[model samples]
Target: MADETPPVDEMLYEQLAQDALRGVIRSALERAALPAGIPGAHHFYVTFKTRAPGVSVPPDIMAKYPDEMTVVLQHQYWDLTVEATRFSVMLKFGGMPKVLSMPYTAVTRFYDPSVQFLLQFEAPATIEEIAVEIAAMPPAEVEPLGGDDAPKVVSLDQFRKK
Candidate 1:
């Protein structure tokens, strides 16, 4: 008897679907960049690979969260700029201010708690690969935060397939 399983996917449909979803993130950021900023009661928790390509953050932050980090865009954020492939913003960590620039490809998850919106992306590089890559890069500027306030983060480990 012949096997019933379908052939492998040559069209890369999964990748295409991920790309389309990333467009949604890009669009939301664009809207958030508007003068009015994100509409009433809507905020985001964006999680990304700390060492992914095109990601820039303070050395202390990268050192603290060598694998991944989640940032909240809420009451205290500045210079929220979105470009075609990446976005940059100023956010406070503890009491210190830092700027982060990240490409959409680096994002693993995006969630808006107020509206219960969530999106998860396929990481282009594995954690081991990211570690190796980060080792090769020069250290970024460091800033120390003195306060106890930390952004709330939601992990996707439970949602990932084992």
Candidate 2:
């Protein structure tokens, strides 16, 4: 009777999109968890706000990356534990291992050099709000491809109502 998909609020939708984007990271890490290590030519360049919430880094890392920092996840990284809410990893800045706890919301950008796909999220309203949102907001929905409607390919139903 009515086409009632509400108009997208770009801002809110962006948040949702970003949340979904992090799901990709989550899934990748989850898969890694299966084998108990990084797998299958997959690596990440994760850039996050050092000052973001739930983020813990050594003093030296903070001093070097006062604002934002990008860490590589290839050939070098340890204790790469990823959970539903947040992922923790041990990385070295100057041959010294440092632990970092980062919420997905704190992640401003994620790049996988293996596949060459990247996702970038807009800055949260305030640097102060990042940690809160990352800890609070549930993971956003993953949108299906082909948009709202399927492509023009006319095909028989695979299920055919069984």
Candidate 3:
């Protein structure tokens, strides 16, 4: 028999690293959830998979944003609660209020324009399970957070290995 090297799976290492990075998001959100709120020019723009396993949102919003959605935690958000595996917050959309619950595993990006900090994650396989043409959807516009400066939006695609 021809000698062939068995394929080594690196999934465990990748999972561990992703979990550790998610902890960073959790820690920052926990700090922001404090009475003082996000301090000293810090804010977050979180992008998550709308249909992820543990995600919950209003049916209409889910329908409007079938594949993915981004949320801002700058000034108008309320009831920000962070837990070990997930977070829930109240936000307004078109003069209507909505609560969103998201697990860390659902998050694909976390960014803070104030410090130009950004983190991007690999989209969970479930994203592929849904057959929506995500790229065809129009981008959601978010109001600027007290500045004329626009945050750089990084596409996770650049980091993916072909």
Candidate 4:
């Protein structure tokens, strides 16, 4: 058997670009902490992996979610706190202000329909892998900058390896 396929890995660039965009999620959350309020209808469409490490969604919410969940951040969210490593916020779930604390690593998507700005990220491959990695990593390992080891920069060499 002869293999005629020339190994091409163009999609690696897309992954890198996608990760770069996901960094904006952290930036937006930082801006969100500016005062104590958001402006206009600039709400958020936040989606997360419920089973990610350090994720605390209400049990009922978790029951309904099972694996992943989407939350609308507008009109009723309060006590939004954004720190370099993680964030905590109060949002009404069925009229009860249940606090949900999330690490950025748990967030899979961040979208602001108001301006059409969107960013999406993923946890390498699988759920169990993500959870294990998150639990094993120290706070200093993912702090967005020097505290975290910076990001894993994708190299073009990957495409040239063949």
The candidate that wins on lDDT is: 3
Candidate 2 ranges beyond 4 A from true positions: 1-11, 125-162
Q: Any runs in candidate 1 off by more than 4 Å, and if so which? A: 1-5, 126-162
Model 2 agreement with the true structure over 55-102: per-residue lDDT tens digits: 777888889888799988877777878888799988777777889888
C-alpha root-mean-square deviation, each candidate? 14.7, 15.3, 16.5, 10.3
What digit string (tens of lDDT, one per residue) describes model 1 on residues 1-162?
A: 977998878887877898899999999989888989998999999999987778998999999999899999877889999998999999988999899999999999999999899999876575567466567756654445654655444444433322
Local distance difference test scores for all models: 0.85, 0.74, 0.86, 0.72
Off by over 4 Å in 3: 1-11, 127-162
lDDT of candidate 3 at residue 51, scale 0 to 100: 86
Q: How many residue pairs clash in each candidate?
A: 0, 0, 0, 0
Each prediction's TM-score versus the true structure: 0.74, 0.66, 0.74, 0.62
C-alpha lDDT (0 to 100) for residue 109 of candidate 1: 98
Q: Where does candidate 2 clash, by residue pair?
A: none
Write down the RMSD of candidate 1 (Cα, Å): 14.7
Across residues 99-161, which tens digit of lDDT does each residue of candidate 3 receive? 999899899999999999999998764554543545654675755787686864646553332
Q: List the residue pairs that clash in candidate 1.
A: none
- Choose 3 or 4, whichever is better by lDDT: 3
